[model samples]
Target: MHFFFHGQESLSILDWILRAAVIFIFVIFTVKIMGSRAISQLRLLDFVIALMLGNIIAHPLSDHRIGLKGSVISTIVIVVLYLLGIFLSLKWPGLRRIINSKPFPLIKDGEILYKGLKRARISIDDLLAELRKEKVEDVKKVALAIWESSGEISLFLEPQFEAITPSFYQLQTEPFDLPQTVIREGRIDFSVLRRIGKEEEWLIHTLRSSHHTEINNILLATIDRQHNLQVFLYK
Candidate 1:
């Protein structure tokens, strides 16, 4: 605690450990307050704040003269400013446009837009690489490609090039459902089971009849909307 304010010429092992743990917890709390968007997907405003925070927080950890209090205060102020900026951008369209660049069409109707490419500051090779990532072998197959503000390329295949689905042939298909995990690591999730209108007794009986195993042996198990139970056992 004494070392936090007064500068130390050298830190002992315990001192270093204490400082690290304190900083680690502080950073986690700060990130939580800043919101998920700060780390998940960085945009223009996010990038600037991230850089500023990193530089500010890093000095306190390495330099003995730099106190944690100053860094913490600066971080809180920056986070507040960041939140305010986000709020303002959401309320004002002009400010939003200035902060977040508008998406521009890089390719349209199988033709590449050279002007858009120049505006985006990406080369032909870069465009080709992005196309390859989307599994597009030919540019002609792409109906539209936009350079998004998040530095992501959104590509759309031409109608003729798009893969056919069951709907295309007017064939009926089962409704989509996301399976819920009922048993994980040999433990039954009673809450999930009840939510799916099932009981532990029914699950145990089904496991015995279908998988020929008990709940304890199952590594993972899921039940879908159709009440289909799929079980995975430990290897």
Candidate 2:
């Protein structure tokens, strides 16, 4: 009786180990096949695939009689179908268009497209909310608004002012435009010299006046449009 009990206990432990191994293998295989994007940025198709994969794996785990071969076959079939869908999307432009529809133009030439809003399944309230998020109080200020493929809204604003004419070109001996050095990390930029109409000698003299002995010590330096040298020290 003691020997029989020991054999039964050993068999039970072996079965448990086999079940665990099956689950581990299936989980790893499914996750790998699904790709890294499954963890984040889940799309509609991705969500459906994930749900189906979970159900397939659960069935084998619950029923020991299902067999590993059947589970593997089902997983492969699902993966193949997913790959085929992706291939169809790429190979056929029309099918791709059907699967991932084009962006709907919500605004054109400062006018709201009500037809686009209906096609996108969004209401006027929804559009107003989106415009508010973009900090646009008036629709007239918006040059264009497009509902992107990712379900996000993109807005383009009209220029603030019109271009000046030749009549406005009056020269009053203003200081020449200076190139601002918004970023610097050690090396002297020759591009900046050409922009400010000054050579290396002028830059060296400017640095010396500011008590900065080396260019490496300065983190950032800028000459504004007004030709004022602004230097920031490295920390």
Candidate 3:
């Protein structure tokens, strides 16, 4: 009877360990399949979905009667659905529009759009709090405050009288598209150059002028829209 009890205890322990290992592997696989963006730029609905998914998986992972195979299968199905949503969003613009709507304008032309706030289901107090967080005290100072699809607030400051064009509030200083070095760590990034509207020749010339003989020697380099070159040499 003692030997039988010991055997049962061992079996229970082994079962728990097996279940834990399966749960860990499934969690890692699911997270990898979801991609890093899910954690970084999560929208309101995304957060809720993630929480619910965890809750659903937790029960099967913890309960001994709930088989590992079933849990893993369910996880795979969820991941497939997520991937399908992403693919559909990419393939169909209409689907993308429906799935991920454009930002709602909270403020426009230095005036607070109260109607837009009501449409977004956000109160005036919430809007004011967001503006304050963005360091915008007066609504008149804002060119536009958009409630992004990701549930993040974006602020665009009005142009000062001195600067004829409207300036984005994110950069309180001069608005410039600082040239970013797309190529680094011995890798070539043509996409970044295309983004800045420059060619290889221009980059080479700019580097040469800055006394950079080789791309490998450059630790960092950025070009602003104003054509200003900011370069950092390797230490």
Q: What lDDT does the true structure give each of the candidates?
A: 0.80, 0.67, 0.64
Model 1 per-residue lDDT at 61: 93
Best by TM-score: 1
Error of 1 at 194 (Å): 1.8
Query: What TM-score, over all chains together, does every model reach?
Result: 0.76, 0.44, 0.50
Worst lDDT window (10 residues) for model 2?
1-10
lDDT of candidate 3 over 13-36, digit per residue (tens): 445444434444455456434533
Better of 2 and 3 by TM-score: 3
lDDT of 1 by residue, 117-171 (tens): 8877778998999999989999999999998777778999999999999999999
The true-versus-predicted C-alpha distance at residue 83 of model 3, in Å, is 0.8
Clashes of each: 0, 0, 2
Span of 10 residues, lowest total lDDT, candidate 1: 32-41
Number of the top lDDT candidate: 1
- List per-candidate RMSD values in Å: 9.0, 12.4, 11.6
